[model samples]
Target: MTTTEHTPAPDAGIQTATGSHRKRLMVVLAIYATIIAAQIVGSLVTNSLALAAEAMHMAVDASGILIALIATILATRAASAKRSYGLMRAEIVAVLINCLLLFTLGGFILFEAVDRWFNPSDVAGGGVIVFAVVGLAGAATSLVILSRGAKESLNVKAAFLEVMSDGIGAAAIIVSGILNVTLGWNRGDALAAAAIGVIILPRAFLLLKQAINLIMQGVPAGIDLEEVRESIVDTEGVDEVHSLHVWGLTSGVSVMSAHIVPSAAATDAGEHPRILDELTMIMRERFGIEHCTFQFEEASHLGHEGLMHRDLAGLTSAPSVSGGQHVGHSH
Candidate 1:
């Protein structure tokens, strides 16, 4: 019998940008699962609300990781007729879910902490110490994974952040445990749990805001509509830019549309292409925007001057005019 060896072709897309993220997410998920199991065991052994809360948070982190992994997989599919934008928005949806989970987890912790404060309970020092150490290790591992591929996708980054926060909460639990063990301060554990909630709330809020912005079709964080308009107006042949709109399809990807009036000379067919190219280049280079739609036109071609004049009267009395017919451009 002859022996044969099998070789598999590599996936270019995965190898280039997404493989590392998938690997990191899987590793982090496994680590978090272990941490959750340990926490559940430790919580029962110690009768500690802090440990239980941390365990619950770990559960949320695990779920978030799974969501991210699914989103990452879906995002790799090619755009189909039914879904023109492919699956990029899936990551945003995953991010939204993660943030909501964190927020809910934070709320639960806060409620439990308040209850514990009203009715204090003893926590086991040994169990706290062990669980805290496990948490720290998990956090450290998550940090390593996130640092390695943080730039790959926002979804992965969100999962990393959830894990990181859980790690910090674990550390706080350890500190509280040490205090309880040495000084017989039962309130410390409750306080530590509350601190965990505090840590999570801000991060959750930020993620929620970002998700909402993307869903609402709001401009990306770093981009200014006014600045974009200024850049267009500053171009050599562009007399003015108006009806400007900017929005994000997802993180780090922005789409913009605007109307521009070209100078009289730019109305010449030859000059129009040059003007369009310059504006497109400026948007790409200066603003880091790739998707753009621009309508080139003469001032007279715009909607009723009276309406535009009325709209701009308070903002600017003088309406800059230019000459050109409408020409649409997109990238």
Candidate 2:
């Protein structure tokens, strides 16, 4: 006989986890709008490459904030029969698009910086400093507003990183401005622009990798599949585990499912629920897995499955007790 059961996730908790930072994201967007305008005019007037790059940085960040806000709203929607997970993945999708935008802007900035380095030009350093300071102050305020939410949501985290990079770019522009005014080093502006570009590319790539992993249903960060398997096998009544899968539905939520073989004694004694309870407690307390599904069966079940579906199971004999089959992309 086989039994399957699940520990369900709370609806309210999922909503709270995904959508608690909408207002903060809106505030950040407002700040970006004001800063972008100031920096754009400052760049044109001062003819400073560093100031222009910072303006482009702020513009992209402003756009990302808007997308993040929309995603945050979408993630709060209730689940439906057709879409069981609701729109929780919206934030992740938003992140993927934002990463693309960041990469494009970062690449352009780098190209410009390189060209400017070869042909250094005059820059009005005193005027550029005024705009850089204004941008820096705006970046600082946005950072404070989004800091709390960054830890809670990936959407907010993306916005937070953008603002943080803008802040750094602004500081770089200030240094370049000082050098141009006091030391007549026009190359400093090019150097600062290059630094800002270098900063942006790595962060964009990292965020893109994370979003792709989530979309592919790869195991969430900090979760070790081997550790989880070992813990379950160490349970008193569980003889073995097979077909185990763990992945994230979105941030702060992890789901796991596995087939378990129970000891003959435990099966005969009708202690299936007890074994499940212990495993569930371990998963929740230790692994932060809120949704779990477990199937209890006899050891012969794997052999039986192999006999019925040899092509799929790829097993010519009884499966090993030490481990289960872990399927991955064929390519």
Candidate 3:
């Protein structure tokens, strides 16, 4: 006999968080739009590479928030036969695209800065400073709008970080502008652009790593697989555990499934239900794993199914059964 536990998709909570925070996101997006436009014009007027790079960065920030908004809508759709997890992974996919865009934008700015270093360009320092201050004001406003939601939502947290970083980038441009105005250092503009590019690269790489890990169904960062296995084995009625697997559906949601053979005493006394309760409670209270599935099998049943000694690969233990069955992958 096989037992399975089915729960609602893990993104249910995210859907609620997104709904409440949607208005704040739209407000920030509008602020970024105005800043990007002002910076672009400032770049053209001042002939400043740093101003141009900042405009591009602000544009990227706006696009990321927009994508996140769209993803929130898609994620709310109900699950269909073709999509078991609904569109919960849409958020991850959007993040992946944003990371790639950031990489391209950062690389382009870096290349421009290098070229400008060789053939210096004249910059209007006072004009660059004016635009940088505008960018800073916008960043500060967006940060205020996103502060509340940042604690509850990953999307909001990401947008908050982007805005915060761009604010620092604006400060860098301001310093460069001041250097140009006071000391006639045309190279400072290029140096500031290069600094912004360098700052973007590490953040893009880290986000890219996280998105790819989620897509590949790798274990989430905070979970210890060995500890989970050990906890299961330590349950009172569990004789042995096998076919155990744990993975995330998205950023904050985790799911697990396992097979366990009940001890002889538990089976004889028909205490399977009690054992299930204990195991489920352990998963929920200790591991924070609310979604779980467990199959309770007898020792002879395992031998019959040719699942004698196999466990989730690399786990330290094997299933106990009376008959001699091979140890390896089960068909």
Per-candidate TM-scores read 0.80, 0.85, 0.84
Deviation of model 3 at 262, angstroms: 2.2
Root-mean-square deviation per candidate: 9.2, 4.5, 4.1
- lDDT for each residue of candidate 1 in 163-228, tens digit (9 for 90 to 100): 778878988998998898899898988998898888889988877887898899988877887778
Write one digit per residue (lDDT tens) for candidate 2, span 80-120.
99888788888788888889998999999999999999999
Which residue pairs clash in candidate 3?
none
Candidate with better lDDT, 2 vs 3: 2
Model 2: CA > 4 A from native: 1-11, 16-18, 306-331
The TM-score obtained by model 3 is: 0.84
Please report the candidate that would top TM-score against the real structure: 2
Worst 10 residues of 2 by lDDT: 322-331
Tens-digit lDDT string for candidate 3 (59-155): 9978999998998888878889999878978888778878888899999999999999999989999999999999999999999999998765556
lDDT of 1: 0.75
**Judged by lDDT, which candidate is best?**
2
